[model samples]
Target: MNENNGITLSIQKKKINDDDDDDDLTGCFKRLKKRKNRKVKKKEEEEDEEEESRRDIDNLV
Candidate 1:
């Protein structure tokens, strides 16, 4: 699995040896990724708002 960013999943064949581990792992990974994206977006927005607030305060001074 390449961890260079984005969802780079490698799915093997679902033989008898392949249980629900792959499927479950993939699903969990997707969920975690979605949550991470949301968190990153929120954090960026908060930072931007903070910058804007600082600018406003500076203008008032």
Candidate 2:
């Protein structure tokens, strides 16, 4: 009975560690996704400005 209890306790501790690791991984991914979104937005805005400039040049011509 004592051995069984010890094994169960170890399993619980392992599960706790696994959970913590999962949480950290999720947080890291969230940060990466947020940064990627910001980069995409900035690129889109730059493209828009480039298009506007091209249109203005065409009008001038």
Candidate 3:
């Protein structure tokens, strides 16, 4: 790469790293990874809710 590309990359990296909330960068990364996890689809979530509601009804009965 050219010298300009190196300089620009360094400047962008510094800007991104300078945020005080950089402390939460790891948490942000974890949340992003969880968002990408394929096991959590809407239908599964709905089914879990239905199961929970059924359990509640059984307990009440």
In the range 2-53, model 3's lDDT, one tens digit per residue, is: 9999999999888877764676887798888888774567668889999999
Q: What is the C-alpha RMSD of each candidate to the true structure, in Å?
A: 14.2, 1.9, 8.7
Q: Which residue ranges in model 2 land beyond 4 Å of their true spot?
A: 1-7
| TM-score to true structure, per model | 0.65, 0.75, 0.36
Give RMSD (Å) of candidate 2 vs. truth: 1.9
Which 10-residue window in model 2 sums to the lowest lDDT? 22-31
Order candidates by TM-score, high to low. Answer: 2, 1, 3
Off by over 4 Å in 1: 1-19
Which pairs clash in the backbone of model 2? none
Q: Global CA lDDT of candidate 1, please?
A: 0.80
Find the 10 residues in a row with the least total lDDT in model 3: 34-43
**TM-score comparison, 1 vs 2, better candidate:** 2
lDDT of 2 by residue, 1-61 (tens): 9999999999999999999999999999999999999999999999999999999999999
Q: State each model's CA lDDT, in order.
A: 0.80, 1.00, 0.84
Cα misplacement distance, residue 18 of candidate 1 (Å): 3.0
Residue 30, candidate 1: C-alpha displacement in angstroms: 0.7
Clashes of 1: 0
